[model samples]
Target: MKHLKEVDAVTTELREALAGAGVVLPSLRPDPVSIAHRYNPPLVELGRCSMEVARRLTAALTPTRQSRGERP
Candidate 1:
């Protein structure tokens, strides 16, 4: 709960930016591994953020032509 607000804010911003750029990312859901057992909420959130961060970083590092809706 401590970082809920921060995480939600970040996720929302990421979603909006991606949407604006015509990029659609899959929603983050409880992992199947977590369903089979118990998992911490903070860690789950961290995982989602990790995924989003990696996605954004990858996109940012990609060539400008590819990122700008141009043929590579």
Candidate 2:
């Protein structure tokens, strides 16, 4: 139907937007270990640390939102 087509179009647009934003959706055939091995452990560690800090900051900010009675 026309609605189905519209829904598909919207989904495709959302996927493209997420890809542009550097988010890769689940893929059935991910590249193997050889590619992963090329990544430097230090760089990976830095990214992990940065993500942890961001998560902690977000968690810390949530209390302020709660004090203001924000929904989340």
Candidate 3:
């Protein structure tokens, strides 16, 4: 729980910095298979990074949701 809170704090700070830079972060939603199929190197790199973060967040949150009897 402490680690989660620390990670959240770091994420918040990073987001604020990005916002101050006028950089709009893209959605981290998993790309549809059709869309992912069209990516070249740069897009692929971005997609991979987003996917990794999304996966880690999902994994961390899932158990907490289950503990609360929530259907995610």
Candidate 4:
């Protein structure tokens, strides 16, 4: 719980820092597998959320934006 909050806080900060650069990262949401227990996600579920965010971030980077059909 504490760890997740920490991650969320840092993520929000990063999101703000990059927003001006046109790199809008997705906000982290509760993992679908653990939505019913939003406050207590298991380690594996947290990992899944992290991976999803990573995938989104990677796709948002300049090199991949053009491939995704957006002007880079």
lDDT string, candidate 4, 1-72, tens digits: 665665556656665665655454454433445434656642222223366556655655647656668985
Model 1, 27-70: lDDT tens digits are: 54334443344344332222334566667757755778866799
For every model shown, what is its TM-score relative to the native structure? Answer: 0.42, 0.36, 0.36, 0.35
Clashing residue pairs, backbone N/CA/C < 3 A, model 1: none
The candidate maximizing lDDT is: 1
lDDT agreement of model 3 with the native: 0.45
Clashes of each: 0, 0, 0, 0
Which of 2 and 3 is ahead in lDDT? 3
> Which runs in model 2 stand beyond 4 Å of their true positions?
27-72
Candidate with more favorable, higher lDDT: 1 or 4:
1
Positional deviation of residue 10's Cα in model 3 after best superposition, in angstroms: 0.5
Candidate 3 lDDT by residue in tens digits, 1-72? 343444455556655654565443454222234333433311211223365556654565456766999888
lDDT of 3 at 42: 14
Model 4 stretches with alpha carbons more than 4 Å out: 27-72
Best prediction by TM-score: 1
lDDT of 2 by residue, 17-72 (tens): 54565543443122233224434221111112355445654564456766898878
**Model 2 global lDDT (CA atoms, 0 to 1):** 0.43
Error of 4 at 43 (Å): 10
Question: All models: lDDT?
Answer: 0.54, 0.43, 0.45, 0.52
